[model samples]
Target chain A: MSHTYRYPRPALTVDIVVFGLDAEDLQVLLIERDGKPFRGQWALPGGFVDVGESPDDAARRELEEETGLSEIFLEQLYTFGNPGRDPREHVVTIAHYALVNLNEHDVKASSDARNAAWFSINDLPKLAFDHSEILKVALDRLRAKVRYQPIGFELLPKKFTLRQLQHLYELILDRELDKRNFRKKVLATEIVKETNQFEKDVAHRAARLYRFDQRKYDRMTKQGFNFEV
Target chain B: MSHTYRYPRPALTVDIVVFGLDAEDLQVLLIERDGKPFRGQWALPGGFVDVGESPDDAARRELEEETGLSEIFLEQLYTFGNPGRDPREHVVTIAHYALVNLNEHDVKASSDARNAAWFSINDLPKLAFDHSEILKVALDRLRAKVRYQPIGFELLPKKFTLRQLQHLYELILDRELDKRNFRKKVLATEIVKETNQFEKDVAHRAARLYRFDQRKYDRMTKQGFNFEV
Candidate 1:
C-alpha cells in the first residue's frame, strides 16, 4: 500500500505572460533578470512556486511581486517541463497568461524583479530561458481565445468605439477584416451595447462608444449564443 | 548569484483523461488502482514522470501503459498542484486529455491499471484523489475546444452522417441545435466533405457520410476561416 517515491523530484516554478494592448500594437510585460544564468536578459515576470501555495495562487503572487500588478484576468497557459529547459538542475514551470489594458497598470519592477517593461510582441528582445516559447504559446492561446470568449474586454477601456474593438480583433487575429461585414456580424451578436456617449478630446468628429454586456454574454453563453469574429 | 533551490521538491506525475464517443453517448476512461493510497478505487490513467522524459512524453507513455491506448489526439490539459491533493505526499500531476473513438481500442485491466472501463460522463463513479476535479476541467476544456477547434473529429469515425455529427455536437454542447441552421453553418465552413459513400449497416435508407477535411481546414484557418457549431 505504499506509493512512496525514491526518485528525485523536479523543482516547480510559475511564470506569467502579461499581455497588454496599446493604441498601435499588442504588447507583453517582461522583466530584466537581476541574477544569473540569463542575467540582464528580458523575460516574463515570474518566480518559483512556494510549497504551501497552489499554482494559481503562486501565479498571482509572482506576477504581483515581479511587476507590481494585481487583479487582472489571469489564466493557466501550459506547463513546460523539458529536462534541459533550465540550466540549474531539473526544473518545471507552470505558465499563466494575463490580459490588461495598458492604462490600468503602470509597470515597474520590484522585489526580485529588476526592470519590468512592456515590449511590443513584434519587437521583443531575446528572452531568457524558454520564455520566448512560453510567450509564443500565450499569444497563440490569446488569439484563439479572443474569438469565442469575451476576453477582448480585458484589453479595452470600459467604453470604446466600434473601430477600437475591431482593431483589437485585427491585432490578435493578425489580419484585416472586412469593415462592413465585421460591423454587421458584431452588432447581430448583441453582446456589445451602444452607449449614449461619444469619444471626447478628439480633433475629428467623435465616434459612438459601446460596452460589452457581461451579464448578457453569460446568460447567452448558457443558452449557447456563441461569440465569434 | 546562486539560483539553486534548497527546498525539497514535490514529486511530479502525468495523468490522462481519455474521452471517447460511442454510438449513444460521450464517455471518459477510468482505471482501477492496484497500488495504494486509494487501492481498488477508479482514477485517471497516469504515472510519475521519468527524469529523461518530457511531461508530454510521460503523459503518452503513462496512458499507453495504463490503458493500452496509443496515437490518439492527446493534449496537455492542466497541472493539478493543490497542497494535500495527494494524501501520501506532495504530488503535482500534469493532466493531459485525449479524444478517441471507442471502436479503436478495447478496454482491459492491463499494466499497472487493474481494470479499465468507460463511464458515461453524466454517471461517473466516485473517483480517486482529485480525479473528479481533473475530469470536470477536462470536460469544460473539451466543450470550449470543440466549438472553435476541429477536435470533435478525434472522437468520431472518419466518415459519418450529418445526423451523427449533429448528435455529437448536441451531446457536448448540452443542448439541441436547429437541424437546418446546423447544416447550413457547418456546410458553409467547407471543412466537411461529402464522401461518395453511405452507411452500410442501417435498417432504414442509408444516409450519406462525410469526412472532416483536415488539410482544407488548416489552410482555411490560415485564411481566417473559423469552425463553429
Candidate 2:
C-alpha cells in the first residue's frame, strides 16, 4: 500500500494561549522568541510538533517548557494557516488554550526563550506572528465556553471565595452579573462544596471558601441537569 | 525583522467531511483512493494544502475538486496532527466539514478520487488513514451544533416542508421529537417563512412548504436574539 510516490508536506506547529486570572484582570502568557523569524519578539509559547506526539501533547509540552506550568485544563481552540503567516517558511499553527491557577506557580522564562511573562488581556503588547488574532479568538471561545461549561474552576485556586468566583466571571464576560442571581444559580447547581475555611489578611470581612466538586458535576450532568448564568 | 533561520516545521494537510442527509438516514461522502498509501480504499475527500492558498481556501477548493460541491456552508472543525497518523509522512490534517444539500447537486467523483458515494452514518465501510476518527468528531460537532444553530437548514433544500425539517432534526439527533412541540418551537422562532405551497404526489397528507429567511434571521440575531429549537 506504500510505494515511492512523493509529495511535499506542509509544516506544522503548536501554539498555546494560556489564560491566567489575577486579582485585577485576566492575563495571557507570552514568550519572547529568541530565534527568527520573529526573534526578540513576544508571541504565544509554542514550537514545532515533535515526532510521535499528538497536537495536545505538543501544546502541553510547549506550555510547560516555556512557562513552567502544567497539570491544567487545556483544549484545542482552532488552527491558523495563512500561507504568508510565517516569513521564513510555510507554517500552519494549531492553537490551543489552557486555564491555570496563577497563584499556584511562579513563572520563570524558559532557557530557550528570552523572557516569559503574563500580560493583562486588556493591554496586550504588539505580538509577533498573527498571535494577537489567535488570542482574540481564544478569549472569545473562553467567554462563550464558560457560560455553558463549568470550566471556570480551572482558572481559580482549589479553594476560593464566592466573591472571587463572581469576579472571575465578570472579568471574562466583560459584564457585571447580578450578585444575588449569580449566587443563586451557582449554589443551586451544587457543584461547589463549601469548605470550613476563610480568606486571611483581608481588610473587609473574610469570606468562606468553596471547592469545585467534579464528581457532583458529573452526577448532575448525567441526570440531565444544566448550568448557565 | 525578517531573516532566514533554520527551525523545524510540522507537515500539514486538509481533510474534508462531507455530510448529506437522505430521507431516512444521515450520510457522509467518502472517496476511494486510487493511488498509493491506502489505495483501493475509502477515505475523506482531502489533500495537501497548496503553498499559495490559505488552509480554509485549500479545504474549500479540495471539497470542490473532489466532490464537485461548491458554495455550501463550510466550517473548520479541528486539526489532527498526531505525528504517527500518516505512515509515509509526517502529516497534520486540518479537518473541515461541509453541509451540502443532497437534492441540489449530484456528487461526481473527480480529481484524484476513483469513486464517491454517501454512506449512512450507522453503517460505514473501512476508511483509509484515520478518517474514521475524523468523521466521528465531525458528526459529534454536527449533532451538538445543530441543536443551538440553524446549520441544519444548510443540508435542506431552499424551500422544504415542515416534515422535512423535523425529519432532519430527528435523524441528526437520533431521537424522536414530538411533532407538535417541534412545530411550536420552530414556528415561534419566525426563521421559517411559510409559502402558500404544499408537497405534491405524496401517499399521505400534503405538508405545507416553508423557506428559511436568512435576512430575517440575521436581523434577529443582530438584535440580540437567540435561536434554539
Against the native complex, each candidate's DockQ, computed on alpha carbons, is 0.33, 0.39
Task: Estimate, for each residue in B167-208, the C-alpha lDDT of model 1 and write its tens digit.
Answer: 999889888899999999888878899999999988999999
> What is residue B204's positional error in candidate 1, in angstroms?
4.2
Provide the global lDDT of candidate 1 against the true structure: 0.84
TM-score of chain B of 1: 0.92
Among all windows of ten consecutive residues in candidate 2 chain B, which has the lowest summed lDDT? B1-10
Q: Quote model 2's TM-score.
A: 0.91
Cα lDDT of candidate 2 equals: 0.84
Which candidate number maximizes TM-score?
2
Give me the runs in candidate 2 sitting further than 4 Å from their true place.
A1-6, A34-40, A217-225, B1-9, B109-113, B218-228
What TM value does the first chain of each candidate achieve? 0.91, 0.92
